[model samples]
Target: MQIYKVGGCVRDRLLGRPVKDKDWVVVGSTADEMLAQGFRPVGKDFPVFLHPKTHEEYALARTERKTAPGYHGFEIHASPEVTLEEDLARRDLTINAMAEDDDGNVIDPFDGQTDLHNKTLRHVSNAFVEDPVRVLRMARFAARFGFQVADETKLLIHQMIANGELEHLVAERVWQELEKALLSNQPSLFFICLREVGALKTLFPEIDRLFGVPQHSQWHPEVDAGVHVMLVLDQAARLTDDLAVRFAVVCHDLGKGTTPADILPGHKGHEQRSIALTHALCERLRVPREISSLALKVAEFHTHCHLLFELSSCEVLNVIEGLDAFRKPQRLSQYLLACEADFRGRPGYENADMPEKAAFQACFDAASKVSAAAFVNEGLKGPAIASAMADQRCRIIEQMLKPFRKNTGGTAS
Candidate 1:
């Protein structure tokens, strides 16, 4: 029997990052044998045990079955005779396929170390198509490691996409990996990779519609909504890696595809439509209500409120006063960041070196000074009698005041 370190924990260690979790693969081991040794058996579909002392994960060297499709379809085979090489072969990417023996001798059958040195992501075997999740995983790794997928690996992914292998991935798994990719350091590459593989169409078909859609030639010299979105994503990667902020980048212009252009001319309420679309998309992905709701508000109001930043303080205050429904100070900060990214992505010489950074800094300072609770407690009673607020009157008022009441003694917009 051989116990060895495998996957990201090992990969990250080689890269000199703090190893968050360490997983061990026990070759030539069975569940019963592990249990006999007093390890706690845990994995439902596969043989996994918790080390009695360290309590770290110890998964048995097992083969898998393609019961259906996607990540969850795999049926595991845990046998005492399973080889470490066999387990590594089933992995999606070479970087993750590397393992380390007890004495720290690295195993590199697929030349994972060489690829790591080259900063390239390549599949371990052609069995890459066996699991549709590999495509998303590959994109995520690209974002995480700043590695370009090798030509052969990219070809395999494209082949899988053309063959409809990626269609087997469920929405939940797609969102999970997509979210990870979005929150990574190079999220734009992930979407670019998806676009290359033709899997973006299979995953978020809505995004596919943005491809050829035209934009205002004068304002958007970039020419199309897809290009604009890609630029915004690139802008996001250059900025923070916050999930909420990145979600805003991915979703801010979703309504553009549906806005009636010619008749309305520039299409009023595109921001509102964007929010509605964001909510529906978040719902489909089954994201948390708190995060999704906040993201929706940011998308819905970003374009509208951003224009107001150039207005007088009176106008800005009026807008902020109307924003009583928004309680989170970070909400506006996130919106400003999204707007700055969007604005910078917008094509125009005048748009460059705009006051957005100063605007965001001002808003952040204001939020630090004023708490949401103070705003709510400023002699405002429960629920506005207005029809628009009837649904959210109580909750909205409560959130508005939360920042106001805190002992920190501050007001924030």
Candidate 2:
């Protein structure tokens, strides 16, 4: 039986990145043969196993058929006769189609190594049209690998979208891929590409409306909602690595277009209104509730950072306290990073540089070591704690002393 290292592990090794996992493609080996070699069978519809010794995945050579629409319609056939070439041919992208022998001889029948070297993402075969999920995967990979899709591949994707092939994808899968894409270093590229190919409108009609929507030119010289979103996404990548925070970056300020005026003139509670809109958007995208909740909280309160310059130490702690009452105080750092990124995305709000960012981080560091006794010892407890904790005195005090609840009350003014 010939066993070869395949897909991402090998690709990452070639790219000098840490290989997260090892996967194998086995040719000339049956499922029974794999089990005989002490591998645990795992694949339900195909022949895939986990090696008993190394606990690495070993998938037997298999072919697939599209019995219906969407990604789940695949019918697979596993056999000992399937060749490495045949298996690689069915792959989505050239960069992911490479394989290597036991001695490390690269098997690249599709010139995937060249594409990898050139940083180009291209489909391996015309069979790419068989699955609608490939478009989303392309967008995500473009963001992940920081590479552009090949022209021919882009053409195929456009054709698929035109034919409504993407409608076959379920909401969960769409959100899953969208989540990864948004978490990438340049999530805007994916959204921009999706818009260009018309998939953005088809999949997310609400966001599709965001493209041509106008913002106040004085504050948002970026002009259009889409560009503003892209700018925020770029800054979001620089802000934090937290997925929920990044989700806020992608979704915050989404309500701007819904206003009657060209500029959201005389708008009140825009932040709170946007939070509600973000929740609906996240739900429509099928994002998990916990993540959606974080996004909404961050979006709702992001504007409060404007008061950070005017805040007292106790006031700062109070703001922190109020935030902590809703979620983990540790997440405040993430929220702050999201705010910093959002501010940077705007025309004149790029003032928070490394020093400013570090100052905010220092507050988080200090909060982490702070305890209830520290508050009392500092004579900062009870009525001395500031009037913002009027109704939440005990709750706020408990949270202040509690290491995990640093942001529970005291900063409304």
Evaluated with TM-score, which candidate comes out highest?
2
Which residue runs does candidate 2 get wrong by more than 4 Å? 263-266, 269-273, 307-327, 347-388, 391-413
Clashes of each: 18, 9
Instruction: Give per-residue CA lDDT, model 1, range 1-413, as digits (tens).
Output: 88999999889988887899999999887778898999998857778899999999999998887787667877888898889999998898888998998788999788888888999888888889888888888888877887888889878878888878877777788778988888777687787777776777877766766777787655565658877887887676676666777787788788777776652212447766777778888877887666676577667556544454333334344444443434555666666677677777765632475454455445434433443454365555445323223323333433443443343343333
Error at 375, model 1, angstroms:
14
The Cα error of candidate 2 at residue 383, in Å, is: 15
lDDT scores for all predictions?
0.72, 0.73
**Lowest lDDT 10-residue stretch of candidate 1:** 385-394
TM-scores of all predicted structures? 0.79, 0.80
Q: Residue 5 deviation, candidate 1, in Å?
A: 1.0
Scored against the true structure, residue 296 in model 2 reaches a CA lDDT of 78
Error of 2 at 212 (Å): 3.2
